[model samples]
Target: MTDPQIERKLIEIMRIINESDRPVGARIIADELRNRGYNLGERAVRYHLRILDERGFTEKHGYTGRSITLKGKEELEEALIGDRLDFVITRIEDLIYRTDYDPVKKQGNVIVNVSYVDKDDFEKTAGLMRSAIDYSISPRVGIFEEDSEDIFVPTGKVGIATVCSITFDGILLRHGIPVKPNFGGILSVENNEPVVFKDLISYRGTSIDPIKIFLMRQSTSVTGLLQSGFGTILANMRSIPQSAVENASLLFQQLHESDIGGLLAMDNESGNVLGAPVDVGMSGIVVSVGVNALAVVEEYGIDVTTRPVSTIMDYGTMKPL
Candidate 1:
């Protein structure tokens, strides 16, 4: 097995190349590494690159630069699984780093927004964000507009909203506003592009009981969630606080073991609640890239019309009814 240090650097190199539109040089990688706080220089990066090349993780293209190989891609994907878990835990720890913070009362979560010019990269970014978050912090996705009135660049952008409690419909069950499960109902909204509105609103709809399975709502085509420019966020539906998660240590331990599915409900087996977020509101993930959205007009299948990730402006933090 590769040493931990080399393994981390290799992952970064593969990610950099993957994120780039074309092949890149060691100098480019080195510059980025410096920007990202890595103390390595170009020569060191080149040395590592040679090693990776010898290992068949990268392919050299004459004088242009080296690109990652299939082996490199698979390696990065496998490494990402572990990184995603660490990222989520670190995110939660960052937010709740207060003295008087309560792990109960309000639900807290993480919001991650990343936009890409390339469609495939966009979907991959969304998947990474979702996988990193959904196991712990309940994420809600959308296109977000910053709380400002003087910027067109930042306005009407769909982004991801990862939160602790199920806002609007799901959590409102406790407030006595019963949100029924949307078994087969497709809500239509005029004059809006793809953003997370009715999907979250309806999916958040749960029966009065908090412990029951949320009648799953087919938000958009499962394809839409993984589309290029517009990505659907995988959110969690949790009413209970993380503190209430029984045997959470074991849950986190399980997280270290295998690929835990991205749902935020309590474990039926161990009955462990693997959440501790206390602040219930919207946290914004600011991403930039967007293309003109096409109107979705499907009556039968998922309506790709309102792209949730496209319309995720932080403005509309849907309140619990």
Candidate 2:
């Protein structure tokens, strides 16, 4: 097998190339890595670049710069999955075993976000979500569609689903919220609504290996949303008012500076940006794990001082997604 050190560097190289609008050179990428605490130089970076090119994860432009290929993006995402495995796995445990679940008054939820390049990929992901949801045996789950009001979603686009876990479906860590019972959904303001994974799936579909999904909500007990799922995690910023959410520089900055290693920081492209400054108004509805949640709350000045869970809605006959 390739040296683990070199393999990591290769992933970082692809990350830089994927985030850059312009072609990137090894020296530029190497320097970037050094700033992030990776110890390497241009020569070493270039040596690996050639290997990546040979592996078809990237392409070279002689003196111009390097660019990532479709394969490269997939590899990067897969690597990210590895990086988040511990956090995800841990949260999954926390949700299932660490918390109390009441069927009559279920108030937990998990939001699933999926990124796809084509119709075929979209369908497979949707089917996977369906299978995962069924697997979870969540009592109630609402797959959010495009909001009729233009304010919540684009006029013409695939509506995203905000799968709510009202019944302690799973456990997740909200970055800025306290580590108690809490609620909030993190989503993009511009995008407004989730991109529904199922609708985009044309009937001629295949299957995808299961992926862990998580969600957070602002209210401690979201009356109707319910859940049941595979290994997953969640985070929420419910206390941050709608006003402060607009100027999320510090919220995202705090996230970047946070030591908790929550959700992956998003990059400038589509879907998730793990370990970078998340976009402003990138909203999520997550319940706090109560551990790392306080660090963000104090820094951002959110007022969810206590877990305000009360008034469980009578969950009567809600269909599952």
Candidate 3:
């Protein structure tokens, strides 16, 4: 006799029926149960099936067999709610899980920026950088379609510290040595191509340093706009006010003597840069870096405290010796 309190027999019966690709005979189910150490008899198995059918959990498909109905599958799923993630990664094992499309092909992509003096170092750094991106973005369970293009509108600065890992690889690999063009911030997107918010500042070789930039918004009312798409978020943030422009100038002036390693635009209130900064070559290059940085800040509904700065100096902008 099966232990009535454990409900083990009933669970086993459901498991077997659910596993079969087609309806299974009651005798087959009972035999499987007995083989698994449950001493349920044929009559007991049939009785359980009738009860399950009455509860809309299973349905008799023909005179001799029964199959799990949609309702039955739902009950099993409900009972297995804690295993949802496991089920998805194991059963479907697709890259992108979407309510509307194939999970495999549509899997979100990630972008990593690595800075190295030599090509060999860049390749090595890429592996570590890729791992960082995977660990940071993958475990956010249920987040799909993240690519370089997905614009994350931060509700607050609370999580910004956690996201800094995206830039750690480049910084650590270079022993804190600044890149030539410096790192042009890194952008990871979900479900689309990454949008270039600003033109990169470059001199000689390819961009070696990369910074990951994100937009911040306080208006919860704008959350829906961000969800519509990245372009919408970019457009909305780009519409910041002129008052922010004046603030950007003040911030830049204050940093004149500070190491000011890298500059980020900030809103007077929240102190967060809402858009990407244009690469300004260096201290006193052309005014475009600061100007473009301010423009980007205003465009993203943010005020700038200082103009953007790069560690590298473009020879083209330097005076003749």
Candidate 4:
């Protein structure tokens, strides 16, 4: 295993290479090291570079220079957990929100306006939305934006309420309100259409009860909560906040030992409320069932949209009605 000192040095090298606009040579790297007081000789730096290249953390070009690879980027991120993660978490938290109102009904509609080439091209759009939510809501979520023309750039704040549009199969559509161009670039175009509207609308058509949807959404919110909590905890870890570290470490341990298919509640101050423990064979089943149940509730809403009478009858039969 690499010692922490060496690992730290390797991470530093990766960070330096990654931040560079052009590939960097070992000599330049050595100079940088000396400037930073690392005092590493050219040979030592070259050795470290070779080690990094061999480990696939970096790549070397023909007789020119070296650059950090994806693995190197990840390694640098993990190593800088004490510095970057907290900033990332704070940025994400500053962007998202949770509200009691319905999205579809709202005037602004928390619109997730999509402008894909085609509606059937759901994968990329969905992926973008999911990624946006994950990054905006969770600290564990990695920064995925790359410096590519094909990649979507988040022009505004990254959390919830901050809106942007994505390209459909080929078309670019905007979500929420559009903004004027600032120093960076022009904001996405505004669309009068609501992407998703939310409000407490009455539903007389189903038997599942409106409260059920609310309950299910709240339950689903648990995942978001955990995600946000994880990010917050991670940020705190990077800052070496004592209380955050202890709490996050304890939570991480519980999560690792948690049943694969089970639920872990954080509302309670206790470590966990695993439906199935890690040692239990049904852990996956427990987790899947919970996720599936939440999905079903989300998709169908509190009331069965299609089988309203049947659902009502079933509910009536189950109760004293």
Candidate 5:
């Protein structure tokens, strides 16, 4: 068995490599370790990498350095399972704290969901995406060509970064209004209108984002909704203090004026929004899911991989799609 301290250092090294856009060398790994308060130098880092390579946890490129292998990812997940409880909610809070987008000024960084699509299918994907944009969290998107550093775009695939609905939560939090993300669910639509939630997975109880679950199950019909005005679409439910409801409404309006509208409904009283209940002191709010378009592309038989609530990016850099 590995020493507990050494095991922790290994996990951190693998995590850093896993999150990198490209293969990382010992120098970069050592620098990252130092930033995280690890005192290991490049030589020590290389020793650890050799151990990882021997264990088949990582693979090395000629001179590009190392990348985590499939086994490595699985091992990391298994080792960190205990620490990932309520991780989705924790990540939301972190992203909210990091979000600094100013809608009034129309600048700053906002949380985004990144998706990768084959370059050949990008045009069709974009058209399909446009069909579902009005139903998406935001109408703006950032496109990254292959080999771009802004975000990982696998070779031959383009990356699309869509504005996440959580940006609303972040903006509200920045203005002193606490927002509580409750669940991700499917909203039934009829005649171009939202009816009720068909399913919900609470963020606090799940390790993974519920939206990703729904997407994986191909549970959304956003394209169907666009074509026939009757289908189930992905959405999220949140709660906020009733006293902050009024202020939240103003902020949401400003968000719309700035062209980031995703607000589907907000309850006036401590009741419910679109049939999802809220606590006594809280008000229910619902918004469209940001990756709804990606689901549509998937439904159309175009393969796409998504990283929901992935990271933050400059809002001004995104373009209308």
Candidate 6:
């Protein structure tokens, strides 16, 4: 087996090359690594690059430097799996910290979930998306047909950006209400009402977003909910300090008036929200997930790959679905 330290250094080298828009030289890679707190010199970086080349993880570009190979990306993902464990919670916290969106001003950066779909299915997808939006955490969204510096649209596909429900958590946190994201799950619905979670995956226990797993398994019945008012949709559970319940409730009202409404239920007395228990001082709350719109499209036999908590975009740029 390779020395763990050396292996990490190689991975970091590939990561730097992979993220670069063009091939990167050893000096550039070395400087980037040092910036990341890795103390590899240009000479040491060249040696590591040779190992990556030998392993078919990188390819040389006529001395212009080196670019990561397809194998490099695969290897990088696999090598980082251990580090990715329990990453969802960290991502949530990061997005929350980055969110500076103001409901009253309706301006600032908010988190969004990006979904890639087949271009041929765009028309039908839009219709289904509107239906799903009615059941989603937010009614606003952004669509992209062409790739840009910030948005990557694959060939023969379109990209849709939906408001993530976590925006609510960020809003609450910014307002002095401590928000604790608990889990993402398939929420059961009857007569268009959220009942309970059919399955739960804690954010702190998963490598990827739980909603992505549920969607991949086709576990949600968002289409069913749209057609018959009975099925399952994506939802998330969170908690807040009991003392902040009133303030949080008021904030939610302001959000709703601003056209951002997805509060399913808030429970403090029962210490539970839709069967998920809350701690003694925390109040449980459930909100409709933003990805439910994409789930509906998926249920209709349309293919979609979702990137939850994908990126932050200015709220003013988004338009209603």
Top of the candidates by TM-score? 5
Q: How accurate is candidate 2 locally (lDDT)?
A: 0.37
C-alpha lDDT of all candidate models, in order: 0.37, 0.37, 0.33, 0.32, 0.86, 0.83
When 5 and 6 are scored with lDDT, the better candidate is 5
For model 2, give the 10-residue run with minimal summed lDDT: 198-207
Per-residue CA lDDT of model 6 for 93-174, tens digit only, reads 8678778888788778878888889999999998998877877877778888755334667688888888888988888889
Backbone clash tally (model 6): 0
Comparison by TM-score, 3 against 4, better one: 4
The segments of candidate 4 whose C-alpha lies over 4 angstroms from its true place after superposition are 83-321
> Which sequence of candidate numbers ranks them by lDDT, best first?
5, 6, 1, 2, 3, 4
The segments of candidate 2 whose C-alpha lies over 4 angstroms from its true place after superposition are: 85-321
Candidate 3 wrong stretches, greater than 4 Å: 1-6, 80-321
Task: Provide the lDDT at 71 for model 2.
Answer: 90
Score residue 264 of candidate 6 by CA lDDT.
93
> Against the true structure, what is each candidate's TM-score?
0.30, 0.29, 0.24, 0.27, 0.81, 0.79
Worst 10 residues of 6 by lDDT: 31-40
**Candidate 3 — worst ten consecutive residues by lDDT sum?**
157-166
Model 4, 27-78: lDDT tens digits are 7787555323244667899989998999899999877899888888887767
lDDT of 5 by residue, 141-198 (tens): 9999865645656689898999888888899889998888898999999998899999
Candidate 3 lDDT over residue span 175-281, tens digit each: 32222222232222223333333333222132111121222222111222233423222111111233334433443344333211123232333222333432333
Lowest summed lDDT across 10 adjacent residues in model 1 is found at 286-295
TM value for model 4: 0.27
Better candidate by lDDT, 1 or 6 = 6
Q: How accurate is candidate 5 locally (lDDT)?
A: 0.86
The per-prediction CA RMSD against the true structure, in angstroms, equals 15.4, 20.1, 22.8, 22.2, 5.9, 6.9
Best candidate, lDDT = 5
